[model samples]
Target chain A: MEVVDEGSDGRVARVSLLRTPLFEAHRAAGARLVEFAGWEMPVQYEGIMAEHAMVRERAGLFDVSHMGQVEVRGPRALERLQWVTANDVSLLADGRAQYSLLLAPDGGIVDDIIIYRQQADRFLVCVNASNREADVAHMREHCAGADLVDRSDEFALLALQGPRATEVLGELTDTELSEVSSFAFVDATVAGVSCLAARTGYTGEDGWELYCSAASGPALWAAILDAGRDQGVGPAGLGARDTLRLEAALPLYGHELSLEVQPFEARLGWVVKLDKGDSIASAALRQARERGPERKLVGIEVPKGGIARQDHALLDGDRRIGTVTSGTRSPSLGKAIGLGYVEPQLSRVGSEIAVEIRGRKVPARVVALPFYRRPD
Target chain B: MEFPDDLKYSKEHEWVLVEENVATIGISAFAEHQLGDVVFVELPATGDEVAKDEAMGVVESVKAVSDVYSPVSGEVVEVNDDLPENTELVNDDPYGDGWMVKIEMTDPTDLDDLMDCEEYQKFCAETSG
Candidate 1:
């Protein structure tokens, strides 16, 4: 990244904004671009609400190339993965993906990652854009002897999510996407581009995440849209992506899972396997679980207006109880929904609280995880 | 993005319409488009005194929160009562039904301080570039 001088229009240039391979496609589709992490990405194209509904009803495509991918291979790859991650890696067979976390030594979360078991001796991990460099560093430090390589630039990831995901992608690929069960992946050719199509997504919809070469990203994106045009496939952006994920109650790295927050406190204790033989924070996690977590993650809903943003103090009357991590007006639920940390006693559903929004206390209540769920 | 010639524009992207001593204020279409979807709006109440070039209200879009700076100093005579629940009007018709406030001016010459459509258009191009 480099700092550039001001433009001729007297405007400061965002010179460091990294453009993904699908940047031209997004611009051609009339996207509203914004800086995310270091990438200049689309926040919306048609509208967040419409795109949100489209994903829930029909299908939506997302360019997630900003998310970094790491390749781990060698004879000791499995042994190394089981030691660095918080999940039971041995249980994850080939072609399967598991949601796991890279835990810091202090029992804090470094990043929530997805490990795709490519083979007996190889794996691929997807990490957050903001934490990509840090996550790679963490893995390299702990994952000695195994061939760990930063393969981020080698792949462009696209997420086609919704009930019609299989159908839309089915039209473009010969993989028979319906055969790719949840969390399973297969090497396939899509629109003449080689891809690894996996039945995994953040939107909590029936969908596939396609990993293709960076050079074929723009072509694959255009081909998917062109193939799924009649299926009402809209190219969704980060705006709809945030709203959709919020509705699903998925923890974003910086928001819910951070260096300061532990897995137990983030309500992601299920991913932690203390018996998995001394992973990064296994001992600390055991100690943490023994002495109950100080605070727990709870869903907060503002039935009234005024969206509660991150760092908005959660209150039990005048006393500050916790803080909101992520908040948005959920397009699917038609209510302002958010995730926050609160004392364990007040973490139960139906417990009442208030969110301080712009100096005003907006009435809110503790709710269950996931403000919305797709039709079965 | 077209800024109507009849409406005076503020550098902060608020549009103003003057009739008699009172001026109706709203964010320009350019501002609304820049702000994706307005999820919430907070307006000054009637009888509240607003100063020129000062923040009088707030407009929260999906991605960002921005202060709605008042272009003229005046007594707040009217506020859009329907705007709290119907914030989409700010995006739907920013020039007409989306008018946020009506300020009875203490200084009628405040209009001279703001730019016309052409000047504001150039300002938008320069800033956006």
Candidate 2:
């Protein structure tokens, strides 16, 4: 939230990064902090691979308080939401959330958001931290007299994710977390702290995203850690989060979904509901759906050699088809995996492709969207 | 960071244990800490020839990728085959079990150009500080 220092001319003056409420906790835990999206967040605590394995086999805690939240409250909230977001917000019942996209008129993504229908007339939208200011400004213009409030600074968000997450969190909350299905949420007191717990996560795991008052972050974090210490619940940072999400094939805002990348091209067409009525980018998305997207996002696996980073060219012989959006050495899969946009014909699973890394074309192949899925 | 007194060190943070003509090479404990949880390692073939200060292998960590340079030129006689399967060894026991390659040095005199434990420690502190 505090990564930018603007000069009088509106230019970026200096990198005066902001620290989250859990900054002290992270420091005390001996975390490696890195500047990400204008926030000095811990990229790793113990280590990425160890933390990643712990989350998959046990449980892990994440400080995601840097992410932005905006509340749209008014009688016309649904109308305003429908007019701006690409997803059909009407389908979301109260206490439910849906992953949606804020799009420009040309079908380009402004930011990927999670819209929580708190009530018939009140919605809470969670957005990427990097796009907080822009997202708030954009929504303000289209709020149509609705109460648009930036609530990012007021809450400290925590994600207790992994297989044992429910067990760890259940010890502190009276709410039956198991009853809350995926994408559902409830208001409850956790660890003597009143918080909003949502059954949603970026990691492909069963977890809860808890939002509490900024002042209560330290106690809540300590209570959860102490409760789950024997269960192997350790603190994780953004580094493990990135690898986990990449393994699940989730799209990050700057990496996968960008201003130049449309949802159709990102293989997120399912979220775009043309029948939801005349919403932002609906016409263009409708045309894209009818005709077909020029490029489609697909999973690319580098069987061997170097890891493909963002912006690396996806090549078919000498011609460039597309570029890598997000990539990492999957700690779960034991191989290199990446998400990238390529020609629709080349998007098929098992299609052969190559990623140009440092001038050499590394052999790769197309796989399914999600490289990893939790065993039910 | 632990830099063994008996080993020769490179400014790049590699440590070499020279026994006659064959030299065992590995990254220092300081280097392993900085890299953070190595997931994958790419080692040169056993018979591949490497020059001093040349990039000989790659270490892919969860955070980023880094090149492993040869401290002394020679033919790679042996590589830790267990590394590709258990890259965590590089972090667990960087100086001992995590030794990357054993090279038959083309010229053992190259070892004199390297730093001792005290010098490498000072180098790490200066750079890290």
Most lDDT-accurate candidate: 2
**Against the true structure, whose TM-score is highest?**
1
Write the residue-wise lDDT of candidate 2 on B36-61 in tens digits: 98878888999999999999988878
TM-score, per-candidate, Cα-based: 0.96, 0.92
- For A1-376, candidate 2 gives per-residue lDDT tens digits of 2345678898985667888999999999999888998889999998998899988899899999999999999998999889899989999899999999998888999999999999999999999999999999889887677889999999999999999999999999889988999999999899999998999999999999999999999999999999999988999999999999999999999999988988989989888888878987888888878889889999999998778888899999889999998888899998989999999999999999999986789999999869999989
Pairs of residues at least 3 apart in sequence or in different chains that clash in candidate 2: A3-A38
lDDT of 1 by residue, A250-325 (tens): 9998899888999999989899888778787888889999999999999999988588889999999998999999
Q: List the residue pairs that clash in candidate 1.
A: none
The lDDT of model 1 is: 0.90
**Residue A312 displacement (Å), model 1:** 0.9
How far is A5's C-alpha from truth in model 1 (Å)? 11
What fraction of the genuine interface contacts, i.e. the true contacts, does candidate 2 reproduce? 0.80
Interface C-alpha RMSD after superposing true interface residues, each candidate, one decimal: 1.3, 1.3
